[model samples]
Target: MSAEAPARPVGSPRRPGVKMALLAFCMLVFSVDYNIVYVALPEIGREVGFSAQSLQWVVSAYSVGLGGALLLGGRAVDRLGARRMLVLALALYALASTAGGLATEPGLLVAARVVQGLGGALLFPATLSLINTGFEEGPVRNRAYAVWGTAGASGAIIGSLVGGLLTDYLGWAWVFFVNVPLCVLAVAGCYAWLAPDARSGDSRAFDVHGALLATAASTLLVYGLINGPEAGWSSARTLTTIAVGLVLGVAFFAVEAKAADPLAPPRLFGYRGLLTAMLIIFVFQGAINTLHYLFFIQLQDVLGYSPLEAGLAFLPMSAVAMLGSGKLLPAVVKRWGVRGALFSGLTGVGASMIVLSLTMSTDTGFLPLLPAVLLWGLFAGMIYPAMFMAAGSDAAPDEQGVASGLTQTSAQIGGAVGMALLIAVANAGLDLNEGAANSVGDVVDGLRLSALTGGIAAVAGAFLAFRIKPPRAARQDGSATEAPPEPETVHSA
Candidate 1:
């Protein structure tokens, strides 16, 4: 058994609230970047003289960088330290954002985005591990996750609005420039507020071979998924890339099984709650991304709303999400426990998707979609925090970083795959070659079909939520009776 590190002094005077706020802001920045460039895409393509087909590399580069490096980032947090990784990540974001804003050519901007994604890969798991390790388990941890989730959920909506406003007022470059000041502020705040990471003496070797294979596999998989929808799915390039990724993935597991100190220790997957939470996160992220993509299409293409108008239309739903996640979700978890809350949230989201599908029409406006949108916000708010809370339910301190990485990796892959499949469902009968010739009615039908498919997946997730087994140290009232002891080995279920 590995020797446990000495505990920190009891009743230390660190201010958790301030630290939490800083962490939440970091999450907000990461989430905002995911979609902020979308509104600026057309302007960017025109300014950089990108070919229509090649323009997508701006977004895909980030996805590829982030998806590929997440496992490495998570493992680094454990080997290095969260504070160290956090500062490094923010620095990368600052430098990359500056480069992106100043880029005169398409290749430069795309390269900048890929660097920004690498920064996010480091930032996300580091921030999450800090949250999971800093807060006490149960209610305190749950509430912290609520605050974190609220920021993250709201950022996606806010990104579009901010992107549209900035792209219109200050130009597309400002969208990238905006992140610089925020990243600098966050870096300053991290140093001022966060407690210094405790030094550890453990000398376990990192599995470099395993890390390379895993990164390569993830990069190829995400690249293929992102490319498959645009390039023909059956294209030889897509098929070959995806097949190679799967082979590398299989090889990664085989390497890890023999390594003395694996990059991703197999034991991390032994916890039933963590496994269940990862599954739920996968489905939840996928469904939510599908809903958001379809909604944007409906608002812009079908209803003919301007970018700004469509961005503004999300205000009500975003407001509801923030309120529900910050205040209501904790109470729900206390009353019903994590499992119950997750089940309820998934069911609600599933039903909301079905209702949303029914309401979407070429003749409809934003008002017609409000009820289902609000319903989605309320329920989705509950799911995000609960899923994370469940992920950390029984994790040891040393394992928190990789555990966070696992959940996030699941979310990233799930979102890509989910969006691709659901989008294919939505575009079923429409010939892209036909373009404007495909009637609005046909497009609406396709979107409705995709939404219904997402709804079915959510319902399936609701059923799977029951598989999570709460830790023995947790009370039925959603508070920890005591901190769980470090386990010598995480036994398989």
Candidate 2:
């Protein structure tokens, strides 16, 4: 895959539709896995003897691994080949899921989740890269992204429901066990249908140092954030880990500036739209993830709802979101353009946040929560496609992998960071000395504050959505040129 890449051959029938669907299915699995653990966490703690304080690691560990390795995974797609990486990722996911299912201890489950996250990291970027290179730009690519976003969000929603059902009926282990069959199907599809990745002539060394530094920084920072609520924020352990994370973060940027082949190329950030979209995604995703996590905890702990009930509560919102993603978004984008769609979407999320903060209460029941949840889902569906389009709009064909990787990384990292902060806010009102004995009033107050914070963030994100502009994918001839299906070329200074 050199700069002077050969054009795609005429009359080659690679079944683009099937390929795209398979890739989207992979994204679905990744999204589902991330949320499945949320509903099952309490059950897991009871069975595995995990302390309440340490249980979050089961979730954050996966996020840390997945978010941290994303950029490197993107680079690997170009150097190692997307199809090959997808295969390896699927295999890793199957193994990790099995390990998690069989685990009897907290530590082992967390370790399995970390490995699973790494597999997802590889799959995430590679799958996106394949889409970027496979589809023709403009209508085709945009529609492909819509389907991709839909699959992912739907997966998250489905995971919520499925996790609850599996935990309630068969125990928490089935949530992990269920992934095996899905992974097997995905693996078979990839092997049978995915086209081989193009080979690049411009060979360069991988930036292992940059990758390690970035991963370490993210893991350490998240570790500190998640732990701060349990240990005092001013504790030596907390401060030390956060400080080390900051140092490593600075070091990562410095190294990237000088690296022969940086994990995140400086060129990719030159696109103003991409930068703005990434920011919007970071904040919006963070806010929503925080909201969902809080809602799950509130339902189970404060409201005393069973896991099955909590999961079922998400169905209406999920249905609305899926409808928006599959049906409404494309029409909105077509009629109002990307910016209009984005702003509209963010407005709903922001409004929901405000409504939730003001009206949500334990005694009011789930009725008070429905409007916000529905609004959040609607806005979320709108935001994902718009953000993804904006992020990759300005990227050259060769840069698509990193661009996609960067966006996904930002979203994941943002969600983790946001969740940490909100959890800390919720903990602030708790007398941990009381442990699980905290009063409903105390819990409700924490949730109200958390909702307020999230609402503010969502409003901020909505304002930022104005910065998004539609990608200029069409040519003067009124036809979109397909991106050359070639190995993304890498260069050294």
Candidate 3:
């Protein structure tokens, strides 16, 4: 029962395709609620009597639970065994979904969502770690991570579409209930094909204090940020919550630096390109999450689109993204080194943001926005897969799970922060526009200004990518070569 640093030789030559699909499916299931619920909200609200402010709690709870606990989730996988955590989390997710879907009151539903997030936090990192267990580094792992990243990118479109249809034809409750069977199928598939491993000395000791402080701080901060839109930013509760969260976060860092078994290893920070990629991920993920909301609002309020229309508008992006990742990214990586491939892809993302910023008008149409969406699809396809490529390549086999989870944690935090900041800014501008312009068009203009903030964020991420180093596999000289099979899925894009 020692940790094996070796890659275990391509996993028995059984095609691997089916197992990878199951891994992707399981990981994506953890996230479906994040996007799907938005589509179901109106119907759920009508039945359950949730106020708008309270609805935000359902979303925030998920983000907080997942984002806050991701580091711990990674460690838990190492300690509790990936198979065990994944099984328990997936089953719990189904139960929680049922609770949320069947709840009689708004508060109960929100509580269900909180549990759902906790399950997701545990499940997602375990899924990625399982992929690491099954696949060797290099092309196999790259392809898997590409598929994995594609699942995450496409989840919004699929979830929204499924949510809308289920809400319209069946009932909003079906959105949650649908996951029950999916989870069952995923568990059966994983158990059949994937071998499970927990890190050596898993039960030696777990990072208990580190988990508590980190989770506490992240939950509070995420809670405050999300709630601040409804609760005034300057209010005592908001400010106090933020301050306390910051204090706890700082303490968590201090603990990590000193702890014998830290939830997040300080050593990972020393990896040449790891921190830089994390920054880019943090910014990009936040901004990307807001896109669904922004598009939803714009399509409905300004373009006279319906709930389904708003959901459908993203189809092009999803299709293009699938094409780019499934086809373009691998070709690009095979041709270009990871550095060139990622740099080029991220540049494409930045350009897409510019195009989006220009056409984010009250009057813009689907046709005018086509180029932007397509470019985003193309680049984000490349960017996300590369993130896994870079991080995993940068670390040891033992570190892949933690690395993957850390990258994911950064994304969740980014999404939460982006949602909060954009909401606050948009609300502020809308108020100002209401005072001065006195029209729907004018208020829409104000919303555009707020969205411009997101564009700025993408630009910043692109700049951040400049500092991200290529993994040893992609490195030109003897110094940068990664130890075998470790370069596929842990780092940022």
What's the lDDT of the predicted structure labeled candidate 2? Answer: 0.77
| lDDT assessment of candidate 1 | 0.83
RMSD of each: 4.2, 4.8, 4.0
Tens-place lDDT digits, model 1, residues 1-493: 3235434321112787887898999999997887788888889999987888889888889988898999888889878888899999999998999999999999899999999989998999888888777765556667788999899878867787899999999999998999999898999998888877777887777889998998999889999988997788999989999999999999999998889999887877777667888898889888998898898899999999887787788777777888778887888888878888889898888988999999999899889899999999988887887887777765666677777778878887888888898999999889788345889999999999999999988988898887775433343423231235533121111
lDDT by residue for model 2 (335-430), tens: 877777777787777788778878767786898888888887877876787777777666666676678778877887677677778777777878
Instruction: In angstroms, give how far residue 305 of model 1 lies from its true place.
Output: 0.9
Scored against the true structure, residue 152 in model 3 reaches a CA lDDT of 69
Best by TM-score: 1
What TM-score do all the candidates reach, one by one?
0.92, 0.90, 0.90
Cα-based lDDT at residue 310, candidate 1: 78
Q: Write the candidate numbers in order of decreasing TM-score.
A: 1, 2, 3
State model 3's lDDT.
Answer: 0.73
lDDT of 2 at 300: 79
